[model samples]
Target: MASITLNKLVKRYGNGKTVNQVIHSVSAQIDDGEFVVVVGPSGCGKSTLLRMVAGLEEITGGEISIGNRVVNTLEPSERDIAMVFQNYALYPHMNVFDNMAYGLKIAKVPLVEIQARVDKAAKILELGEYMQRKPRELSGGQRQRVAMGRAIVRQPQAFLFDEPLSNLDAKLRAHTRLEIQKLHRELGITSLFVTHDQVEAMTLAQRMMVMNAGVMEQFGTPEEVYSRPATTFVASFIGSPPMNLLKNAPDARPGTIVGIRPEHLDITATGWALRVDALEMLGFERLVYGRWLHGAGNELVIVRSDETQPVPGLDTIIHVTPRADRLHTFDAATGKRL
Candidate 1:
């Protein structure tokens, strides 16, 4: 495993005035044996960034270093990185063992060494019994595991995943996530995973880079990103229900927006009056969507109430208090944390 570094990376399509710049000057240092997730919505340049690092996309400017070597001009095979894509990309005609060992075979590795490597990968991925099975016979999760096993056999300096779990069902995705976590724990390989799912990003990442519109909005641990979002875009995008940003909030300062998470608001007898618009039951907890009564614009606010709390009726007026310490302040014009 080796460290990966992106120094002022840039990517542009077309030339002259028609040039479309997708990736801005993004830079981040990924430590050796660390798992970093690059997460964002589609067309946000997250995949583009990953492809750049994988040497699949040409860099318009700046340098990409894998370990001690600068790999800007290197071919994808020469970069010593293994990429697991969204598609399984397995050979239907070949069995799991042959699929996993194909690259090593092409590289002219000894038959004994190829068998050893494929066996080790199959054992790691729990595919020992299905080594002779074709891709058509395997389940989706198993096929994904085969794809991963193929990469593992390469034993590259780093692993790059481009939405590898997107094709699976919810349960399979969750299960595969655990398998991936276990794989990382055992191998300790440097991994850069790209995904649009926030849950995947939060759960799998040692550190996550949140990107938007080709710009990296924030880069930090999941805890840091959730607890202290640097900008309004991040504040709104990172959470489940997302942080509520109210422009016309009570006791508001000029040109500032008050941001609060649903869970941080306490339903109280006296505070900000909220007229309940809707209520969503989520097993152990309920989400109360309401409009602030006092504000001129009647901005919407959501409050999370646990099973211990009473569920409020629709159109009923309920008071909720925002925790002073938990409130986030952002500059309304710039959408940046203040």
Candidate 2:
């Protein structure tokens, strides 16, 4: 296993006056055997950042180190990292065993050692029964497993995953996520996974890097990012229904905005008055969309209520109070936590 480090990494396209910068000066240290996920919305340069670490994209400026060596100029093969792409890039004509063993064979590893490695990887991935099956004979999940097994057989210093679960069905994606967690625990290889799914980042990361428009907004554990976001973008992007940012909240300080999560607002007999606009039933809980009737008079707010709570009628005025300890204050102009 190896640690990966990025020092003020930058990526730009074109040149001179037309240079379009895609990645700003981003830097982070990924400790050995740690699973770090890069997550953001589409076109946010998360994938581009991952590709740079994998030695696929040229770094416009800055340094990338894998283990103890500077790998900025190393080719993909020379970097000693295994990459698992979204599409299962398996050989259609080769059976599972041959496909997994091909890399070692090409490297001139002893035949016996290659067999042992392939066999061990297959057992770990639970693909022993399908060792002789061609790619056409396996399901999508199975094929993906074969791809992972192929990477495992090489025993590289680190692993890179580029949305490896994007093609899987929802149920299969959940199952594969568990398998990946187990794989990391057992092998303890350093890994960097890139994805747009916040749930994946929240569940799988030992630490996560949240990116926006090529700039890294925050790098911390899921709890820290969710509980105390650094900026308004992180606050609004990390949550499900998102935190409410009210510039004109009744009790908000001047020149500051108030942020409250949906679950932090409580329905009360008397408090801030809100006119109910809509209510959504989500199995175990409900989300109430309402318009605040004070301050700016039209600020929208969302409140999460459990199934036990009585549903408020639409257009009816209801009172709610934000938890004193749960309220977050941010600078109105910068959208940054104050």
Candidate 3:
């Protein structure tokens, strides 16, 4: 395992007149054996950042160092890093064993050592039973495991995952997420995962970097980022139903907006009255969407509820209250946390 560091990293396209600067001056340190996730919406440059670290993309400025070596100029193969892409890039004609052992073989590792490494990786990935199966014969989850197994044998200094679970169904995605967590716990290799899924970031990362339109918004633990979001975009982006932005609130400062999460709201008899407009039943929990009474612009707010709790009917008026201390304040003009 090795520590991964990025200092003032930058990426741009074209040059001069048509130059489109994507990734800004981003910097962060990923400690040895730590799993860091870079997350954001599409077109946020999350993948671009990962590829930069992997040496697949050129860095227009700054530096990326894996362990003690500056890798900005190193070839992908020379960086001592392994990447698992979104699409399980396995050879359809190769059996599980060969696919996993192919890299080692190409590197000229002794056949005996390659066998040992493949066996160990297969066992760890629960792919021992499928070693003889080709990619076409295995399930989606199994194919993904083969991809992971291929990376595992490399035992690279770091692992780069670009939405490795994106191709799986919801249940398989959850299962693979647990498998990944277990793998990281056992291997404890430095890892960087990039994804647009907030839930994945929240569950898999020791510390996560939140990106927005080529800029680094916040870098912190899932708890820190979720509990005290660094920006309005984060407040709105990180949560399931997102935070309620009392845009143009009567009492808010001219350029600041008040933020409150769905789960932080309560139905009270004495608080602000909300007219229920919609309901989303999510098994054991429910989400109530309503607009504030006596407020203009149809500004909606969401309130999370337990299945056991009763919710108001649509168009019914119910009072909702926010935990004052949990309120987030952000600059409406700049979207930065205030």
Candidate 4:
């Protein structure tokens, strides 16, 4: 219901010269009711940033504001925010209903009000029938739903999800992703989800904040991030097979790095000749992996081929072409976009 602002946030540990600064002067404005995912690789400080916003990690410098109120010194309990952790954190002895209602019970919300909220959340989450089931009786997806339901019952200003879907299997993860999208539409709650998975970031985020080593690499729509990555890290990390970073390109300007996604490449009579080294079939499509024969094939490039296309034998030379507009250029020295 309110916009969250992180103004030059910083996090560090230890004292003086021995200090390890993990998060560095991060700033972002998350609009009200926006589902923004903070995505990055492991040790990139995505979770640490989320924790700072949730008031779980103390900000070493800068201010955090929720709905115009600065919450820098506020305790986690007083932040008026609900956090759904990766672990679900459901009490094994309690039923789903109890798990969702415990926070309200602690806050001394009216029992009728608590019941109404929990019931509404359970219904929204399609968890009505599982209300009496304990954590032990539920599957991974259901337990994750219970965690979401607990947050929903709080009806806080915003929701902070820390890899809420990490534990689910592929099918369940996909299903629950749709469930989350529906839940967000129904409730219109402001949310910040943290994940290392770019797939989740692409599917779930309205605007994604890409972080790398405590610095925000880019903040934009999924399409913008994909089509025009801000740096080599963003270019390489956002895609599935990742963008092929062509280092020391024969034709590129000095210190320039070229990047191209696998899908954008085509098997053509013209263009670069890639030395076919490997292939991986992924049902509908195949991944052709090889190096550019002319340029020393220093880094393996991947090209997605449809099932209809014939798979070539290894060691066979494959000529590849890249879509002209799909080319991404960055500085080899700083890795920043050129």
Candidate 5:
């Protein structure tokens, strides 16, 4: 139950002549019991920052604290933290119960206390029925849960997860996400998760950090990041199929890019007309793609609708309209929201 703080964190490799800055001057405060996900594209340094906090990576500069203690110089074992890696890392020969109790054994916790903690964790993770099962006997999702249970039995001040669900199938990943959320609520331990999946970040985070090329793009609730993205990269990266970033003229007022989400589009009877290019009928919803009018060029604009309207033939005319708020403007030079 500790709040984590980062102050001007910096990670650089090589000397000043060729410094490869993996993390810039990063600073953030994660409240106690907060479930914060750090999300970014590959090579953006989200995992680097998480590793620094875990003491797995050295911080070139700045301060990191857990509760009121500065832990930058502490070894991973001394940080009062538990980490659940992407790989389950379970011992092949160890049974679930043994795996969960191993940490306590290493710390010389009394046998009875270890049993009580392991048993409690097993119940929480629904592993009571599989306590005797070895890693080979369990499914991928089960192994992931076992990794989580191992961390839980420690009752550490915080938990760090690095793409914990990357290996699971879609359904199992979704189920496990819910389980993790529930576990967070039950344990109330401070947690930091790192992932590239926007869906996972959106669903699992109470607050989140969006990182880009080692710099934090945004830090706020999922709603704030989604509804009011601070930059064009964030606007495009946070949503499915991403926000449409249409290029406008250099003299295009204050906004060089016009953004619109597919769901916010309207199938208007009269508006900027276009020729139907393609359609995707997805049971409950449909995506319509068409060429924009006003010499808007050969590129396509996408719109989503719930009603399976007439599937227009290729090149057939279709008009589009969008809600005013759904339309976004971004500065051309910096690609920042306007």
Candidate 6:
């Protein structure tokens, strides 16, 4: 395992007056054997950042160091890093064993050592039974495992994953997430993962970096970023169903937006009355959408409940309030956390 560091890294597309910056002045330190995830919306430069660390993309400014060595000028092969792509780039004609051993063979590793490495990786990925099968014969999940196995054989200093599970179905994605967590625990290698899915970032990362439009918005553990977001964008982006923003609340200061998560609201015994406009019953929980009686501008709020208590439907009044600590305050003018 190796520690990775990015020192004021910047990537620009052109020169002089035509320069288009893709990655801003971003810097981060990833410790050895840590699982770090870079997450953001589409076209936010998360994958570009990963590629920069992998030597696939050029750095217009600053340096990237892996294991105490500056590798900005090094070739991808010389960086001692392995990347697992989203598409599971495996040779359709090659069997599992050859697929896993191909990298070692190209590096001129001894045949005996290559066999040992392939066997170990296959066993770890549960691909031992499919070693003779070609990519066409295996299932999608199995093919992804083969891709992972190929990276494992190299035993690189660090692992770079660019949405490795994006191609799988929902059920398989969940199953493979557990497998990935287990694998990380077993190998304990330094890893950098990039994905747009916030749930994946929350579950897989020891620390996560949230990016927005080529700029980093927040960098912290999953709890810190979720429970105490640094901006309104993060407050809404990190949660399921998103946070409800009281854009023009009468009680809020001028240029302030009140943020409340759905799960942090309750049907209070005595509070402002909410006229229920819609109800969505999930298996384990139900969601209530309502408008505040004293509010204007068509503002809506959501409340979650697991009990089957009767709730007024289609414009019926019910008392509801937000949890004190769960209320997030953001400056409407700048969208920054208050």
- Predicted model with the maximum lDDT: 1
**Candidate 1 structure, TM-score to reference:** 0.98
Q: Write the per-residue lDDT of candidate 2 for residues 1-338, one digit (tens) a residue.
A: 89999999999999989999999999999999999999999989999999999998999999999999999999987898998988978999999999999888988999999999999999999999999999999999999999999899999999999999999999999999999999999999999999999999999999999999999999999999998888888889998899998887788889998999999999999987899999999989899999978656778999999988899999999899999888889998887788
Candidate 5 per-residue lDDT over residues 298-331, each given as its tens digit? 7677878886566666778977776787788888
Structural similarity to truth (TM-score) of each candidate? 0.98, 0.97, 0.95, 0.95, 0.94, 0.95
| Number of backbone collisions per candidate | 0, 0, 0, 0, 0, 0
Off by over 4 Å in 3: none
Tens-place lDDT digits, model 4, residues 96-154: 99999999999999999999999999888889999999999999988999999999999
lDDT of 5: 0.89
Clashing pairs in 6: none
All-Cα superposition RMSD per candidate: 1.1, 1.3, 1.6, 1.6, 2.0, 1.6
lDDT (Cα, tens digit) per residue for candidate 6, span 1-338: 79999999999998899988989999999999999999999999999999999999998999899999999999998999999989988988999999989889899999999999999998898899999999999999999999999999999999999999999999999999999999999999999999999999999999999998888889899999999999888888898988888875445777899988889888877775778889998878889998877747378888887766565577778887788898889999888999
Who wins the TM-score comparison?
1
Task: Quote the lDDT for 264 in model 6.
Answer: 85
lDDT of 1 by residue, 1-338 (tens): 79999999999999989999999999999999999999999999999999999998999998999999999999998999998989989999999999999989988989999999999999888999999999999999999999999999999999999999999999999999988999999899999999999999999999999999999999999999998999999999999899999887887798999999999999999998889999999998899999977747467898998999988999999999999998999999988999
Which residue pairs in candidate 3 have backbone atoms (N, alpha carbon, C) closer than 3 angstroms, thus clashing? none
In candidate 3, what are the lDDT values of residues 1-338, reduced to their tens digit?
Answer: 79999999999999989999999999999999999999999999999999999898999999999999999999998999999989988988999999999989989999999999999998898899899999999999999999999999999999999999999999999999999999999999999999999999999999999999999999999999999999987888898889888885445787789998999888888687778999999898899998877748489888998877786899999887788888889988888888
Residue pairs whose backbone atoms clash in candidate 2: none
lDDT, residue 118, model 2: 92
Instruction: lDDT winner between 1 and 4, please give it.
Output: 1
- In angstroms, give how far residue 217 of model 5 lies from its true place: 0.9
Worst 10 residues of 5 by lDDT: 246-255
